[model samples]
Target chain A: MGRVVVDVMPKPEILDPQGKAVAGSLPRLGFGQFVGVRQGKRFELEVEGDVTQEHLDAAREAGVQVLSNPVIEDVVAVYADTAAVQA
Target chain B: MGRVVVDVMPKPEILDPQGKAVAGSLPRLGFGQFVGVRQGKRFELEVEGDVTQEHLDAAREAGVQVLSNPVIEDVVAVYADTAAVQA
Candidate 1:
C-alpha cells in the first residue's frame, strides 16, 4: 500500500484561536522556549498500489479542493509518505 | 527562528469519524483511488533561536504531555521543519 500525506494550515492572515491558546499555556507549563504555535491538519490517504505521479496529482487536487478551505486555510503540502510505502 | 513540528494521530483502534467522512466523499469527488483516510493534527511551535537537541527534547515532552491525549491519540512525530528554519 502507498500513502499520501497532506498538510493544511490556516492562512497567515487568518486568526487561529486554538494555536493562540496553546502558545499562551506553554510558558506556564514550563516550556517557555516556544514563542508561537500554529495548529493545522495532517491527513494520510491510503491507496492500494505503489504511488505514482497520477496518484500524487489526484491527492494534490483533493488536498486543495476537498481537504482544505481556501477561504481561510492553505494546502501546505501534498506528497507521498515514503516510510508508509515501505511499511 | 526555528519551528518544531509535532504530529499527532488517533490510535489505530480508535474511531475517526472525520476521516471516514473524508473517505466517503472522495469517490463522489472523483478521487476514488484512495482506499482509506486518517485525519490528524500538526503543530508548529516557533522558537526564538536555532533548533537544538534540548529544544527538540522539550518539544517531544510537550507533544506527548500537552499536544496529544495519551488515551486516544499518539504523538507520531516530533521534528524540526527544516524549510521553516530556513525561511
Candidate 2:
C-alpha cells in the first residue's frame, strides 16, 4: 500500500487553545525546556497501489478542502511516504 | 529558535472515529482513490536555542509522557525540523 502524509497547522495569527493547554501543562510536568507548543493534525491517506501524482494533487486538495479549515488553519505539508509502500 | 516535531497516532488496534468519518466523507467528495484515512496529532515544540541532543531526548520523552496517552495513542515520530530554524 501507498501512503500520503498531510500536515495541517493553525495559522500563525490564529489562537490555539489546545496548544496553549499543552504548553501550560509542560512546565508543571517538568518539561520546562520547551518554550512553546503548537498542536496540529496529521493524516495518513492509504492508497491501494503505488501513489501517483494524481493522488498527491488530490491529497493536497483534500488537505485544504477537508482536512483543514482554510479560515484558521494552513496545509503545511503534503507528501507521499515512500517508505510506507511495501512490495 | 529551533523546533522539534512530534507526531502521535492512534494505535492500530485503537478505534479512530475521526478517521472513519473522514474516510466516509472522501468518496462523497470525489476523492475515491483513497482507501483509508487515519487522523492523528502533530505537535511543534519550540526550543530557546539550537536543537541539541538533550532537547531531542527531552522532546521524545515529552512525546510519550505528556503529548500522548499511552492507552490508545502512540508517539510515531520525533525529529528536528532544520528548515524551520532561523539564524
Candidate 3:
C-alpha cells in the first residue's frame, strides 16, 4: 500500500493564536532560543495499492479542498515514501 | 535563523477517530483507493540563530515534552530545512 500525507499550515500573513500561545511557553520550558512557533495539521492516508499519478493528484486536491482552509491556510501533499523526511 | 518542525502522530497500534472520520469521507470525494487515514499535529518553530546540535536536541526534547502526548503519540523533530518534505 502507498501513503498520502497532507500538511496544512496557516498562511504566513495570518495570525496564528495557537502558535502564539505555544510560543509564549517556550521560555518557561527552557527553550527561549525559539523565537516563534506556528501550529498546523497533518493527515496521513494509507491507500490500498501502489502509488500513482492519480493518487498523488487526489491527495493534493483533497489536502486543499478537504483538509485545509484556502482562505487562510496552505496545503501540501506528499505521496509514497517519506524516508527523507525526519517525520 | 534555524527552524524546527515537530510532527506528532498517534502510535500506529492506536485507534484514531479523527482519521477514521476523514477516511470515511474520501470515497465521496472520489479517492477510495485511500483505505485509511490518520490525523496528526505539526509544530513549526522559528529559532533565532544558526542550527546546532544543541538546537536539534532542544527541538526534539521540546517536541516530545510539549507537542505530543507521550502515552499514545509519537514525535519526530526536523531541524533546519525541510525542502525534501512535501511541506
Candidate 4:
C-alpha cells in the first residue's frame, strides 16, 4: 500500500481565529519568542496499493474535495512512499 | 526568524469520527481505491530567531500545552528551518 499526505491550510486572505488566538497567547504563556502561529490540517490517505500515477491523482482529488474546504483553505498532497520522505 | 512544525494526531487507540467519515465518503465520491483516511492537525510555529535548542524545546512545550490535548493526541515537533524541510 501507498500513503499520501495532504496538508490543508487557510488561505492567506482568510483570518484564522484559532491561529491568531494562539499567536496572542504564546507571549502570555512565556513563549514570547515565537512570532506567530498558523494552524492547519494534515490528512494521511492510505490506499491499498503500491505507488502509481493514478493513485497520486486520486489522492490529490480526494484531498481537494474531502480534506479541505476550497472556499477557505488550500491543499497540497505528497507521495509519502518516496525515499525522500522516509529519510 | 525560525520555524518549527508540530504534527498532532489522534492516538491509535482513539476513534476518530472525522477520519472515519472521510474514509467512508471517499468511495462514494468515486475514490474507492483509498483504504482509509486518518486526519490530524499541523501547526506552523514561527519564531523570531534562528532555530536553537532552546527554541525547539519551547516549541515542543507550546505544542503540548496549546496545540494538542495530551490525553488523546500524539505530537511530534520538528525544526522546519533546515533544508531538508524546505526542499
- Interface RMSD values for the candidates, listed in order? 0.5, 0.6, 0.8, 1.2
State the lDDT of candidate 1 residue by residue for B55-85, as single tens digits. Answer: 9999999998899999999998888888755
lDDT of 2 by residue, B8-87 (tens): 99998889999999999999999999989999999999999988999999999999999999999999888888766543
Model 1 chain A: which ten-residue window has the lowest total lDDT?
A78-87
The digit string of per-residue lDDT tens for model 3 on B1-87 reads 566777889888889999999999988988777788899998888876666777778888888888788999998436564444322
**What residue pairs are clashing in model 2?**
none
lDDT digits (tens) for residues A1-87 of candidate 1: 999999999998899999999999999999999999999999999999888999999998999999999999999888888775533
TM-score of 2: 0.94
Error of 2 at B87 (Å): 9.4
CAPRI-style docking class of model 2 based on DockQ = high
Looking at model 3, the pairs that clash are none
Please provide, for model 4 over A1-87, each residue's C-alpha lDDT reduced to its tens digit, 9 standing for 90 to 100. 577777788876789898999899999889888887888998877776566788888777877887789999987435564422221
True contacts kept of 1: 0.85
By TM-score, the candidates rank as 1, 2, 3, 4
> What TM-score would chain B receive for each of the candidates shown?
0.94, 0.93, 0.84, 0.80
Model 4 - which docking category?
Answer: medium
Query: What's the residue-level lDDT of B17 in candidate 2?
Result: 95
Question: What are the Cα lDDT values of the candidates?
Answer: 0.92, 0.92, 0.79, 0.77
What's each prediction's clash count?
0, 0, 0, 0
